[model samples]
Target: MSYERHFEYPLSASSRLTGSLALGDLETGQRCYREGRLSVDGGRSLPISLTHSPATERLMYGGEVECIEHLRTSLREMGVELPGSGGRWLPGPLLLGSERTRVTQAGVLDCMRSPAFEEALANRQEGEVVVLPVLREGMKYGLQEAVCDVLGAHCDEVVVDAHHVPDESVPYLGRRMELSVFKDADLTLAQREKVKVAILGDSVASGTVIIGLIEVIKQRFPNVERIELVAPLAAVYGLARIAAFGNEAVPLRAHVFESLLNALPPEYYFSPFFPEEEMHMAKRAYSNYRDWWGVDKAGKPIAETACAGYGWSEAFFNPRKQIAMIDEQLRERHGMGLAEVLGRY
Candidate 1:
């Protein structure tokens, strides 16, 4: 792995794929990342750029990834090690790498443009690594640019337009927006020579769009060796969807390397959920949630809500519309005004 360093995920399901057990429908793989804590520390950094929110950093490298607390209190704690695995993940495929330093729009772009990152992409040595960033959002945080900067003329890019919104089944916590469909695809790698690897980089919340895009990719660009998700802050629930897809359908070899995947609160899908253990990080935002939401009766703030991120659909949705949507959600759930809520933050 080209990552300068990688945090360990002892409970990742990828660690259990060796025996052909057909690991069916892993329940979003939520509890696996953390050792025991169900919530995480995060909130109130403020948005630094149109592309990302400081709320995001709290989950990535900003906060301590402590959910991985349980385990091998005994010699049995040392999980299986694949025969020749080289990456942090014990599975044969290497973990997706990122410098994972302080999160910033500039830093994201700069890192991708760095010589080290370029070398990382080049070293995918197994075969051609097609960069398939989901449309609109994929273009953010320098994800799409990374492909261009790294590969330049050799950049084989596929921009996919697959978005996930509230589904009819339940607008609560984001129901499955069935990503098994696609609206559009640009520069798609259709029916080409066997491209063994594909990289998907995004903030994976609801895995709807990804599963849909992957379906399209496998259909159009069939017979690939592996699909790697380069998600910055992926939800365990979302990753679970991908796992389910791989387990049931085409049997794809996907590698996801997220340091944490606490329970995804249905409210914001990503946040308002707070881990009491995380008071040390994003203390301001944490306080904001506790003070404003008044938290649940248990005194727990909505998990993942502190700073689940704002203007997430900036690529496709305008700010005005985005705020309006937030306003509606705020009123429906909290019975609070948008200005009242936003102002508190």
Candidate 2:
């Protein structure tokens, strides 16, 4: 039972997280990852690869990859030449793939050929910024890479756009991974009763991680009920671009906060940030903050306390401090392996 049929496939699938979303085959499994896009419905047909027998023929019929190539041809035809020594491509919309096409690495390459896209790129003067939304670990990584290459070709000094990383990785940097949940464990009674949990960061990655944890916890603690996400929902990548390009005059942070208030249901209220809220509420509930390395064992309070002093008083003047703070926070809070902390609760 999918919540919404059309919006379901390219989403944070529950079955895959639980290891039940399989067709029980090997070649099909490879196809799921290797093939750019099997269907527009976000790789729903990918399970075929998991279930395919040894004799399963590779049906490379005019699938997602083909559509991506078409998008690339369209971009080139529209005159948005991605500048480079030779021609390489941006990965497609791996995260945003719908039923119409599995927007893979090649598909994003073709998007460059689109007339609307070219028009978007053409206006970039020396001091302008281009905001690109891409997947961290999947095919969309190519899109980020390609966009950077083109920006370098066109701009006088192209500064790469990066978002907040919970790893030792820098801010504005992008990480990559396949679409799958990395952990599965039951939650304790306290965790299940967490009526208010804050999802601090951004990205579809955050959504997947948060939802996966919720599902696991719910399964593990069936007796308890009512788990909630506390933070206002704002895409970190989008916020980063608005911050960088819109500059101080626009008050982007306040704007995003307002949008978040609007998007969410009326019951939720804005807190300082999820990390801060975790520090305040960790005593009452067993909360967690997740990142690329993996989920941590410490309570949300410990994580927030560790990151409290990060960032400079004046970020514009002390950008290096900002980066170092980011580095420190990631190193300190992330990198912990899963633990049996649930038993303590």
Candidate 3:
């Protein structure tokens, strides 16, 4: 069966696939592709060349298959390895990209222009990696569908991005939109004492998340003394609590990371780009690193969220979107490398 879906924004081929699972319809896109006949909307979505925002190229990352690989590595580290007898069944047949029938005409074109998309289309990359910020109706245009046409050009191993909704968009449109869905797992990992650790910046160690991890630590290392903690702030506190505790000390390892997560979940993931209409309507734009441009002094136009409205003008959306991806990848890779390095201790 083929999956029939709709999007408020224009989508790239890769992103369409990501959104497909959520669409929860028949996989018509696949069936149509096999039958060699599909009917889809015909439209062209333009790529942004230069605009008010910083210019950066967007890349697609992650997939169910990749998730499985990552999960395997994680499980293996936890001491569970699949046997050969388990066969391919343990790892299901992954979809290289969303089936073409799922995409509209313009989505196909955007996918063609993407190097990652092209590589996947040409059978160069492993497990279906594609590039995006795909133009859809609400966010991108028809870039999702184009990916469908291009996938066949590449080897069958390709994976599609398949996202329907625009990623969360904030005024700064940075990493702030990514949610930390695995905070519990993160605490568990930290509990293993497998990695050396360092804490940076100002943060609290008494937040709910921190308290939870501290309990875990207490259970694991009951007699560890004088936990050496280093931080800019003597103690971190919420706005309400900051005044009460002028200076305080808490176990460093237990609360630091958890506090950081509570302070910022969106900063950990990619922010979806909003449509021009939505962008213009925003009150302000926010980024994980810093605030973006704001409204004019006199306020030629004001958006709802003052911080977001003035901060996220449409001009910078494309550029900021691209730059965010590059920066995020570097951060992810670096942090992962750092984690592995620390784990060696």
- Backbone clash numbers for all candidates listed: 22, 34, 81
Per residue, candidate 3 scores C-alpha lDDT tens digits across 176-254 of 2122221223233333332122111112222222223233333433432212221111111121122121122322321
Each model's TM-score, in the order given?
A: 0.50, 0.20, 0.18
lDDT score at residue 241, model 3, on the 0-100 scale: 20
* C-alpha lDDT of residue 343 in model 1: 40
RMSD of each: 17.0, 23.7, 25.9
Order of candidates by lDDT, top first?
1, 2, 3
- Evaluate model 3: give its lDDT: 0.22
How far out, in Å, is residue 265 in model 3?
18
- Indicate the TM-score of model 3: 0.18
Best by lDDT: 1
Over 4 Å off, model 3 = 1-206, 226-250, 253-292, 296-345
Model 3 per-residue lDDT at 133:
22
Whole-model lDDT per candidate: 0.39, 0.25, 0.22
Per-residue C-alpha lDDT of model 1 across residues 1-345, encoded as one tens digit per residue: 111111211223243211111111111211111111111112111000011233233323233222112111211122211222122211000101121222323334433443334434655542366766665555554554555555653545666656667555532223443443243244344423456566665666656666666666677656655565555444444454455432233333222222323433333254323244232123344454345444433444433343343444441234344445554555555565444532432
Q: Candidate 2 on 1-345: residue-level lDDT in tens?
A: 111111111111232111111111111221111101112222122111011111111110011223344333333443323233332222111111221122223333333333323434554443233222222222222444444555453211111222332332423222212223322124234543331211111222123233233343344334322221211122222222222222121111110111110111121111112332211112121122212112344434333222221231212223334334443444454542112211122
Poorest lDDT segment (10 consecutive residues) of candidate 1: 43-52
